[model samples]
Target: MFNRRNFCQASVLACGAFAVASSHLANAAAVMAKVGQPLTEVAHLDWLCNAVGLTSTGRLFVGLPRWPGFENTPSIAEVLPNGTLKPFPGGDWNEWEPGKPNAKALVKINTIHIFDDDTLWAIDQGEDAGPHGINPGQKILQFDTRNGKLLRSITLAPAVLPAGANLNDLRLDSGHAYLTDSGLGAIIVVNLATGVSVRRLADHPSTKMSPERRPIGEEGRPLQMPDGSDHQVHSDPIEISPDGKWLYYQPLSGPLWRVPTEALRDTQMSEKALGDTVEFVYDTGPLTGTAIDSAGNLYLAEYDRPRITVLSPDGSLRVVAEDPKLWNPDAMIISNTRELYIPVPQSARMAANRGPGGVDGLVRPFKIYKLQLPALYGNRETVPALVGKPLA
Candidate 1:
């Protein structure tokens, strides 16, 4: 039932997506091309959306979303090169620190990278603080990747967090960093050394609105089903280029945007200056997620589509892979060889088997799959083919 060809066909539907299909994969191939079979389906998370990252120490880490849907699910996973999925050591899904506020769930993991020796920063969207739908939510927790030790928990400064701000994905600079407040629709800046942070572009037009916000028909018109229902999607997966020259991001719906890293980090610059540098990179009707290659290319997973397209460093678009199996291709990691590893989400399928929160009412068995085809997977140095073991 889950094969590469199903992925290919699924991509066609997503790209041509007017609506998410309710039909089984076996009956869908005639409409789209299928790629190779899913290398494996990872069922460790409660629900998997944007939980993806390839760390420097030859490991791949995945963040899991736990909650009403993902009850008793894993909070983090390390995909070992041997293709096994193992629990992240920091916080056991069942254990919360003594006298601490109740840990609700895992929303999304921004990205995993070695911030310093033996230390890795795991940005968790604690829980969408603004609206009930904000999601996987805003806690920025740090850990020692070496042995899964809890190092620190970074909180939003009162100065930076207006009440009801939900932090999204995060990107790190040498000594500074940036995070997106999808709940509040703001860009948060943090000084790593002092942990002093500030929020900017709270409602910047670049980050919030998009013509791509709505799904488009294959003919480029707003696509909808015969029933006259609409598919509404927003927020997203984002990444800063390797050299930190450009920040490329897109909300779920479309119209990917970017601004020069210099402009974004130039805290001293006027708002007009920062806004001046923010540019509309390109528009896709609806995209599932995006990843940046070391060479400065961005690979976007078209939400309902099969192909993973690239926004070249030079501001051009190219199709990196047109495989059929990339259905619901969501977050991705680019290894050193430029091979892209995407976690094609099967939430729709799992949702079918389990109910809303999934089987057992816990959204059990959420799957994040990996694919290796033409492109860098991310500065590859024998990182696990998939991160299944704890960081050594």
Candidate 2:
């Protein structure tokens, strides 16, 4: 006869097995209450959460990079209202094993954005730097937000992404997409229709990180690499204007720059001509992610001071929100509800592959927060104007 002790032990084992088998939907249901005012804690993740995006309907999507420990975790997930993370566009697209066939896998999602057309777009960084060298898996993906249906998957040309390239943030405008490669210090422009892409501003002053720049830690100290040198991230922030005419961007440490959309699409234009189109906007001291409003105002996630700054269309900078709880705000999205959603990953504190220090380890249960915007802010409830000619 089975004793009570044995029964309890077996029951516990059964529950453990169930949880492991259903890891795909783990921690997505538990609700963690708000931590602070204005900055309400949204979904909490034990893994390294990088960026968050919201659809026009207010659906939440979050991305997890394949860092050291979370190699096989879902690269992209939909955070339900109940706070559970379900693989977006579902199925085995997010599942991958080393030796198995991962042809359709979302290996590592560096950043994701929901566009005006109700489509979700992402930059899959592909491979991380293993002990050997840079792993290679970069690709661009597009999906329908309504049903998680994948619309497009375009593998980037090797010429666009060199050996050290780390595909970072992306912004969609008109019919084209602009992507920043932080590791290689360049900007890539892609024609969505034909999937043709070209690398731009490679080694251009605008794309390179400020030589003396270093991200500050939560304790108000300069972040340093293991070697004691200043830590840095290259061209990581890119945002398109509400009119789709201008593209503003800069490195992690920056003096911001802007260029006309026409200049990026003109493949035949000489390098000097393209460079001439770029204008020195302003010096954004220390920033991570950015978003733009229809009124042409740019919202910046200013990391050092830990606040959101609005760069007005007339070239004035003003603080939008300043809260002590805002630590290392990464990717930001302006929702149709006139709210800016910021995901505070505290990425710099987390430990990288080597050990603690840069990317060492921060407080767990990473959070996403939203700050309301004024009613006059241009909200993209419907699809924005798709300007410029479609690809041939």
Candidate 3:
């Protein structure tokens, strides 16, 4: 006796209930953890907070990407330990207008990296992909973290950023920066001194997302793109060995790979040669972010399994911690290798999970958690002397 309308309503309600049950299961798994403990929620936000950075002096910076359900607000802000948000550097940089030179301003901050030298580097993802005539909206900015003043800004060349380039996270080594382009499946390397950035390993199997792995979420549900396509999280997490000899990188769903930084720095290196140099590491199911300690240990976040894994220099892998609270763990940073900070955005509840006209599924108050560990070395301040190293 039920009509089509009633059937559809029932289906939606059933799916919602299923999602809730999955969340409960995840929480239950958290209780089974025997290694690292559940995340200590630092600050809560009503909006999507995808990126986080911590300064040695204890300043916390958060980036809010302009995604669906994002109330028109500043894209980047500094969160005091007391949990107050202040527009970073300046609010004007976040205010964008159609005809204005918005590229110079902080349009949309995809990631932020706080260095030991008190410099804050940010990747500003300009407009979404479209036939807008290739605007110079994509760039990188460095600021003096101590005073929240701008230091330098570099607008990337059009060739470096093709249509649909999501320049995700970055790692700094010596005087160079390496960035991952998730949207186009590529890597971008920038010279900190010369401000010249080059794109590398475009469409390489190592940089491309896995066709076999789908970022599953609540109730074993696969995350979906806005167009109802399966969400393919591409090359995102990146790290540099403490010695700065090798650059470790992988797609969100990984079979981790690395190549010598010596080869990576060579502007003349052919794409085929670079591909030939890539060494396959372990197969990590899916990891969104990674950081390396001074001893060359790599910490990777497996958001789907809701745990963090550590890969040693000798190729040994172990689970550092597992907890249900690690939902959609995105950007991660290690503070002096003593603490690992992870932000859980619960993206399975975001709009893209449900496609167009999708209702908001996530609860309010997003989370940032940290893990304490034995004192270790971090590479932010230890720029290895790889400037003139032999590539051979």
Q: What is the C-alpha lDDT of each candidate?
A: 0.53, 0.69, 0.70
Candidate 3 accuracy as lDDT: 0.70
In TM-score terms, candidate 1 sits at 0.70
Winning candidate number (TM-score): 3
- Two-way lDDT contest, 2 vs 3, winner: 3
Model 3 TM-score (2 dp): 0.84
Q: How many clashing residue pairs are found in candidate 1?
A: 60
Misplaced by over 4 Å in model 1 are: 1-30, 35-49, 55-57, 80-85, 90-119, 128-137, 210-212, 215-235, 347-368, 371-392
lDDT of 1 at 86: 72
- Highest lDDT against the true fold, candidate: 3
Clashes of each: 60, 8, 1
Per-residue lDDT, model 3, residue 106, is: 71
Sort by TM-score, best first: 3, 2, 1
lDDT tens readout by residue for model 1, 103-181: 4433444445443243456666554443444232356766666677665667675567666556666766666677766
Give the higher-TM-score candidate: 2 or 3.
Answer: 3
